[model samples]
Target chain A: MKRIAGKKLVFFLLFSLLAAFPQIVFAFPDEGRFVFDEAGLLTEAEKEQLEYMAQELGAERETEFLILTANDTEELDLSEYIGKFYDAQYGTVATNPAGTNAAILALDMENREVEVAVFYKAEEYLNAARRGYIIEQITPYLSEGDFYGAFSIYLQSVYEFMGTEPGESPETDPLLPDPVMIGQEEPSESIFFQWWFHVIVSLIVAGVAVALMAHHSGGRVTVHSATYLNQSTSRILNRSDNFIRKTVTKRKKPQNNSGGGGFGGGSIIGSGGGITKGGHSFSSTRGKF
Target chain B: MVIHYKCQNCGDDMVFDSNTGMLSCHSCGRRDRIEDLPEEFITARFTEDEAKEYHCQNCGAVLITEKSTAATTCSFCGAGVVLADRLSGDLAPKKVIPFTISKDEAVKAFQKWCRNGLLTPKGFMTGDRIKSITGMYVPFWLYDLNSRVQARAVCTKVRTYERGDYIYTETHYYDVFRDINLDYVKVPVDASKKMNDELMDKLEPFPYDRLKEFKTPYLAGFLAEKYDYTDDELTERAKGKIANYIESYLSSTFAGYHSVSYQQKSIHTNKTNSQYVLLPVWMLNYDYQGKQYLFAMNGQTGKIVGKPPLSSKKIAAWFAGIASGTFFILTVISQLAGGGF
Candidate 1:
């Protein structure tokens, strides 16, 4: 009974705990930003550079670009440029040193053929100029476009600008591996185990309930039936007529002796004929049966 | 003639209470049990044949009297019965729903509703300006119907390809078919002519299963009016609702089809049943600047719906307060982060 009660109490507590503490599954954290531009214009070389950058950074390719143009133009049509790039065999192009009239194209590497932006400004276009330089310096030797050269150069410059070593990676960052993230993973494992654990606990609880009910009935039957049998035997013994007759005969002589002396004087004739008179009262006949 | 016990104070007819199990006088607040009387009286359902039309002796207003009817005062003049209506007919309803919420609870609910109103006029919540509120059982028709719909539409799928150094477009066509079965579409139609149909429609859908049978005893603490609209009139409104559902369902079911042109659609309905149900609503009518505003409360759900007065000054002040708080918090955070505050 105690074990059963304990099991039931445990079951209720488990249910309450489950209801109170809901398990939350954390989603994968977002990796990095996808840079985007308003206008779409990309040469084949620019697209390759973006794909390589995405791979190096461990980020997904995003269909967005930043457009840098020479003029402050809100609207520019780049359909002809896009069509030409599609037909061209060479991936990269280098313009003459008069880079003021140059257009720096960025492609949406994820979608393959969508031109994201065209950057044309020269004076204030350090990133575009660097990218254009990297493409021009490597594409001719590589036969198509040198993605590794552009990616490595960009990463090296960003590391230098941030005052960090170029060899640093996220895997070795001490502060980035936060303790809270580690703590959260254990609870996720426990949640996965909870389904089977609860089933086993429920079976234990059911077994306990059955054991408790059986124990209660066992005590009741033994105690009640013993008392009932004792009462019935006592009633039958007292009702026997032979035991009553014996007990009555044992008391009869004593009762008669106590009454004898009071009437002895008047019954003096009782020795012979058992005739007795009290205060001269008339005595009549004798009868024998 | 049966002797009728009537109230001496207000002279209104006393009603029998089954909860307290006594005949209660509404006017003078007197109560007595019928079991205390010498003879047992069985209150019969008032029929048109057994009803007597009594002309009001005091005000000449016609009144109906039955076995349970007890009248001491006239309805119009508020005077004791001098005469009774001679041609009065049976006006008592077959069933009624008793008031579930008390007057105090209703007022508290109303006040809570007022506090929640984002835009309410100044002094609107003051005790002096708070108008007398009334609990009314409004009549409505609940309809259940089985609807079947058939629709046909022309659908298109787009395909693009290159032909001789130029992109060309190709379109494909296919016929669309939709068959649907709908059941127990509950549509509520307001029975009162004074109530706005549009407002009632917006406050849709009280759960009809919770409705209790009508008992006149429930009317003791409330003001109620019988429905004036018939079933036939409400059926017309139900048809309009069904038509609207058909149009929307057809459009959404085939939403994937590009450039869908509907050819033909038909909706058929059968096994329609309607019941006249009364629902409890707490009404607050206020007149502000010559315009009246109506507020309603769902008695069962306790959800209040209404339009409250807006104050431009309050709104501006609130917006400014939020902006100041936001700026202060951001400034503190930035300073802590070694950024220019």
Candidate 2:
């Protein structure tokens, strides 16, 4: 009878853990190094350049920097896949005078998704507005099959966007090999402001509709009341409005990049750096390149 | 300095007839060609101080006019008199768009405009109580400007993605610029303070190609006024309008930005060329309930635009009609849903 009772108790405890596991989140410290190219898209020299730049930027800004590219996610449930492995292998403190907040940029080649994970604490440097700008800088190159150029631009822009003094390398740990961390079902990612993004999109769409309606109102509405405009001939003298800058943004693309890769019903989330899958909400802007 | 045309065949006064668009003699029934008039109309010149009044030789009636009044009819004999001085010197208009449509046609056009759409009052101007219809050569200042516009804006583009347990937002910034060169010609601003700015604006798109050189015969049948406002006063209006046009031209060029806001705007006018001219307008005024309702027609294009007073009764009827229609539809729909169909 006692043996049977023990078996029942074990089953009950296991059941309880399974039920509560999805809701539980774990916070981990930051790692000294940031740039990781798991997809092997970057060369040894290029990888070293990105890592060096990220490390210098991280040390100066006191905010963690990560640039990771991975192949297809292992057959793990997408919601459970996160920066958990990276989180557990990194820093000791959440916020120090020096800095340690999680900000990860993950490029998934198989799925054609470029995920940027920003932690709550590091949101100041990687705010909503700044993130949108960075995507614009990276997408054109991404669509044009220039992954290296795109990644390089992204890394440099991020470094500058954080308001860091370039070439001013603060005291950081020496270079180390990439850590091998097989992630478990641990949560360490957070997201905020999905509704706010939607609201902004709605307002923009409505404004565009109203502007179109106004444009078609009348011919008289567009020009001033000088009768000569109808009779005047316009000449373009030395006409040039060349592109000063070329940037592209992504906003929930049906397909990723100009490659026209068909998207499926699968998702893989990143976790870590004081964030988890359950209560730590996350928001991202995506679109076709 | 007032000039009048006389019938060469009958030796009677020849007046401009609106229906025939020619000088017609009422006594001898002689029709003369206006283009056949001599070239003295071009060489002739007069100043505001050179002419004050004149007497009709045939009718023996005195005609009085202001310095700017170039054309009028004798109140006693009803003879068309042209103040040649008003059409000359500094007061002379370099260009003139004569009244092509007659008074009868103008009144008919006004009535047709009142019947434009459902929003207009049903019987607003159909009662033939059009108190007065005046053909006026509204003084205008035409401007020719060559401008350069440069705009600077802070634009943002946002991209987003999701990985594992987190969604990421990626933002980028751009320093956007637009350099535009705009050459505006024949932008007209009314130089007569007596004309309603709004009314004149609605009478836009005057046919400028038909503009004829200043001629004395053109004024014989029409009432004309010299400019009261100087170029300096109207320049402010013209510049304001140019600035608005260039700004709109710049903003329309940008596309595909999540958010774009202008940080700096600069407009430079290389040179402004101006001319004192006159535009033709058929001005119609009606008095309803002691309130004057004015209607202006573009004498060139005949496109009419104006704001007419709304009738409260009409509005109430519209609301009632819509409400009842909606209520009936809902009632039928609900009954069908309840299996009463």
Model 1, C-alpha of A121: deviation from truth (Å): 25
Error of 1 at B98 (Å): 4.5
Error of 1 at B324 (Å): 12
Candidate 1 chain B weakest lDDT stretch, 10 residues: B82-91
lDDT of 2 by residue, B1-341 (tens): 76778788887777766566578888999997777777564456654555455887558678876656767777877777777666666777788777778778888877776665344456674666688888778889888777777777877777777765455676677777777667888788898868888668767667778787766666666677878888777777887777766665566556777877778877886437788887888777777666787777776667655556565565555555554554455545534442311
Which digits, one per residue and each the tens of the lDDT, describe model 1 over residues B141-220? 76766666776676776666664545555666767767765554446677767666755654554555555544333343
CA RMSD (A), model 1:
43.7
* lDDT of residue A171 for candidate 2: 16
For model 2, the superposed segments whose C-alpha errors exceed 4 Å read A1-289, B17-21, B26-29, B120-125, B160-168, B305-307, B320-341
Model 1 residue B200 CA deviation (Å) reads 2.5
